[model samples]
Target: MLPAAAGYDRGITVFSPDGRLYQVEYAIETVRRGTLALGIKSTDGVILAVEEKTRKLQISNVTQKIFQIDDHIGLAAAGYIPDARTQVDHARFFAQSNRLIYDEVVDVEGVAKNLADMAQQYTQYAGARPFGVALILAGVDKNGIGLYLTDPSGTYIGYDAVAIGAGSEQVTEHLEKNYRNDISLDKACVLAIESIFMVSEEKTGTKHIRLAVIDSKSKTLRMMPLEEIENYSKQVQDKESQS
Candidate 1:
């Protein structure tokens, strides 16, 4: 086992002798315990899927994992819900501010970069702590469809497809085998659903799954209806049975 970072382990503002921030690493581990959130970018669009856990008996069934940052951008987060909400709020503010200032919607990459920069600031400040969330952001811009993953450390990267949270390793392997560069939006949605199913610990049904899709042609970001998701879940199960 690796030894703990001497002083850095106690605070986010501290860096160890090995140049590691133990507090940031600990925050990332918190995200790993969240439900799965995955994204895939395809020829026609991008799809984001997340597994929703119903924590309380009286709570609503609607999943809170997926959120909209703008008309063209959507985000799904894996980690503490409160931290996710804080990040999402920040993203919305930046996106809107850019539009008001530039008279154009903020591009997907721009939004990701701004959020990453903000998240990174928390790690460098003495009193602040890194967000315990990893975000999967998807959207359509002038450059076309895009997908990005941002971690608690404020590091962000683009991807054709990616997964976060528990069982992400298995989900990544599944994506590698099935992902295609020329995949269509419908196929991408199917893959996203399948990936979530593969990694989720609980028995995930349609109601427990939430999805967001950004269509390049329509230039719209919309959430998949529960009914459609239910149908897709049935289709995935049928295909698995046949296989």
Candidate 2:
């Protein structure tokens, strides 16, 4: 636990002597405690994967980390689930509004930028706390497949690959060594699943992983069925054994 820096972190609008928002830093810590969520952008498409955890045995095991913002846009979030849901709702609204007003789908960066603007407001406004989550937005747009990462501080950026939440360091290392610009969508999906498995503390299987993909050919966003995820996991294992 970090020692309270006396009068600096108590308020969201207060900045420390070094010009850091302690509250935002603390909100980022909340994201670090959540299960891993990762995205990989390849030549053919973008793949997003997330770890699913059930707090109770009686609860459903379905994961809510991956959401379809529109036909061509998807998001994966790590951190406070409720905050993530709120952001997803905002993204959906923006996408629909863009279609209605402009007669075209919202660009990938536009969605991210709008959400970041909303998040940034919380940090500047009095009595409002920063969101305790991080998001990875992936989509297919006119320019091609795009992958973006955003944090509670309202900062957003594009990435070829990214990992957030617990065990991100390990997953990031794996991606650095294996990720390639020309990797196929199928291979990217497998790589994402494998990377998640490497960092998860709990034993995860196909049933515990959620995957979404956006490709140029399909021009649509879709989540993979459990059976397909299982097959991909097997392929990954087979390739590992061969080497």
Candidate 3:
């Protein structure tokens, strides 16, 4: 006997009898298989973090999951990262073009919408697979801090704090308990690390953590240094002991 999704699973454009898109669902499952990635919006700005496992001999300095889309916007991705790079390149071009034409920075929501629209297009066409990556986009703009999550099903939603990838459901529950809208940027950084550590295997060090921030004051994106990450890790440990 054939399964319910038998034929629908083979094509992005086909919908199952139950009105589900199997290819899109499969793409989302690819995101579930990735390492953890998350973002938090705080009173001061936004923080993005991800867990990355590396071989001992690997340099480990360069981050593979976090990317800068513009001076004020940063992205953290979980899933098929090659798809992420391709999307990032497209976003960079779109951002620069927006600046050139409007003589102003693009709105964070605009970029999110653009990517969501692009993702949607793939679902309506044939001969191409949906992007298997999910992205957390965070930025500081005139509207203040913005954070959005985009998935392979062509969905984009806003969030104060969100997580994606392996163990994300667990980490997300942690964020729900710990996240505060009034939290300071430094505190948000600590919270981001704490959430990652809750699910990360290399629990003791900052080596597997990749961090980035877009502060309201600066309205620019910057990578958090290892030294700062170590400090945040200590804070996470200290808070644990007290609680």
Query: CA lDDT of each candidate?
Result: 0.87, 0.90, 0.92
Alpha carbon lDDT at 184, candidate 3? 92
Q: How far in Å is the alpha carbon of 220 misplaced in model 3?
A: 0.9
Q: How does candidate 2 fare on TM-score?
A: 0.95
Of the candidates numbered 1 and 2, which has the greater lDDT value?
Answer: 2
Model 1 spans > 4 angstroms off:
1-3
What are the candidates' C-alpha RMSDs?
Answer: 1.6, 1.6, 1.1
Candidate with better TM-score, 2 vs 3 = 3
Candidate 3 residues lying further than 4 Å off, grouped into runs, are none
Candidates in descending lDDT order? 3, 2, 1
The positional error of residue 127 in candidate 1, measured at the CA in angstroms, is: 1.0
Best by TM-score: 3
Per TM-score, what order, best first? 3, 2, 1
- Model 2 RMSD in Å is 1.6
Q: What TM-score fits each model?
A: 0.95, 0.95, 0.98
Candidate 3 lDDT trough over 10 residues, lowest sum: 1-10
